[model samples]
Target: MINSRKTDHLEICAQKDVESGNPGFDCIELDARSNPGADFKAVDTSTKFLGKKFRFPLMFEAVSGGTRKAGEFNKSLASIAQEYGLGFGVGSQRAMIEDKSVADTFKVRDVAPDIFLVANIGAVQLNYGYGVEQCREAVESIEADALALHFNPLQEVFQPEGDTNFYDLTKKVNEVCRKLKVPVIAKGVGNGLNLADVEKLDVDAIDVGGVGGTSWAIIESGRSGNGCRLFDDFGVPTVECLLELGELGKPLIASGGVRSGVDAAKSIALGASLAGVALPLVKNYFSGGAKAVEKWLSQFMFEFKTSMFLTGSFKVEDLRGKVLL
Candidate 1:
């Protein structure tokens, strides 16, 4: 059942019109300078997260897994991360947890041994009998560098078999963060994370999978007979989330409608540690292949570097709180 859902999600996301909302990137523009006072050819986009250095502040966010075809996508995506020195995350591992035989579908250490790989699972699962043990297994089984406990109450509400029991989920997440050996990330599955909700999570980082990217509600609605269409545009925009969560003192990962390197640069300037791309990369992979994925990323980085240069920011760190409207 879980495996089937994974396939359904990948198919709908790749083939259907799943994206909605404005990530607010369109409103935020970089202060461009004709002569940046630095060499454009020497712009540096490298940064460190989870003690690993990324060639650029770009992460191939959690997109697929839990099936043979999904496994191929994971391998291809991870290889791209390895080649580019970026971060990679697999989709929810609930399928592997339910049936261990499918665990290989989420493992990519053989091909992406050096990149910062993140293992993912639904935080709501904690309310459904998943705890530290299961969380650890998800990480160790895949040799992941960190763990992203994704909160998807909105998507679950739309899912036909959704586990909407979010009662005291924060307490369980804190327990896992304390007990889990690897760094724990509190992630939102679209619909972004608010300040109040973020204060409750003792996570090491945050992936504001805000709206403006793939609408999980829309995806579930497609599977559940279009009942969730009303909430297709739900959640905070990615830019708003960054503005609200910038002072929390935790590394921020900006996702949801991050289409290009310029969007990525805006995110970094607003205090995001990394800019994540999911649906577009998924589409690129399906429509083309690994080479296509690589091509898209290459262009994204080019645009990001161009933004950095035009903004007079040499390194990724220089962009923090520097760019203006």
Candidate 2:
């Protein structure tokens, strides 16, 4: 059941019109300076997150796992992270936990031994009998450097077999954070995280899987026999999530609708430690494989660097306060 669901998700996201809302990047404009402090060739995009350094402040957000096809995607995407020195995340490992035979589908250390890999698990799984031990297995199985406890109530609300019991899940997440050896990140699906949604999480970082990107609600709705469209556009926008949580002082990963490298630069300037992309890359992979994905990433990095140079920001840190709403 889990394996089939995983495949369904991958196909729907790649082929369906699952995007909803806007990430609000259009509302922001970089304050280009007449004198860029550094030369374009020398601009630095490197940054550290979860105790690992990345050549670019970007992450290939959780996309797929738990099937032969997903495993192939994981191997390929992890290799991309290795090549670019970016972070990579695998989809929920519950399928592997339930059926260990499929665990190989989520393993990628052979191809990407050094990238900062994040193992994922639905936080609501806590209510369905998952515990800290399972969290440990998720991290150890994939040799992940961090763990993302993704909270997707909106998506679950639409899932046919969704576990909607998110009650007291925060306490459970806090427990896992206290016991897990690796860093924990509290994440959202496409609905983004508000201050109230994240204040209680004792996570090392937060990935505001904000709106303006793939709408899991819409994806599940496509899977649903009955079309549910009312809440398709719900959730906080990506930029709003960053603005709401910037005061927390916790590192933020702006995801949800991140498309181009310029959007990533805008995210960094708005207070995100890194930007994450999923649908765009997955679509690229489905259409043109690894080379096509690599080409897109290359262009993305160039755009990001150009954004920094235009703003006269020499390094990732200089992007702060470089945007005007």
Tens digit per residue, CA lDDT, model 2, 1-325:
8888889998987788889999999999989898886679989999999789999999999987888999999999999999999999999999999999999999999999889999999999999989999999999998999999998998888888888998888889999999999999999889998798699789999999999999987898888865768888798999999999999999999998999988999999999999999998889898899999999999999999999999988889999978999
Stretches of candidate 1 exceeding 4 Å from the true structure: none
Please list the C-alpha lDDT of all candidates, in the order they appear.
0.90, 0.92
Q: Any residue pairs clashing in model 1, and if so which?
A: none
Clashes of 2: 0
Give the Å shift of residue 122 in candidate 2. 0.2
> Which lDDT tens digits does candidate 1 get at residues 1-325?
8888889999998899999899999997887888799788789878999798998788899977889999999999999899888999999988898899999999999999999999999999999999999999999999999999998889888887899999988899999999999999988777999899988889999999998988888899899896646788798899999999887989999999999999999999898999998998889999999889888888998999989888899988988776675
TM-score for each predicted model, relative to the true structure:
0.98, 0.99
- Model 2, residue 208: displacement in angstroms? 0.2
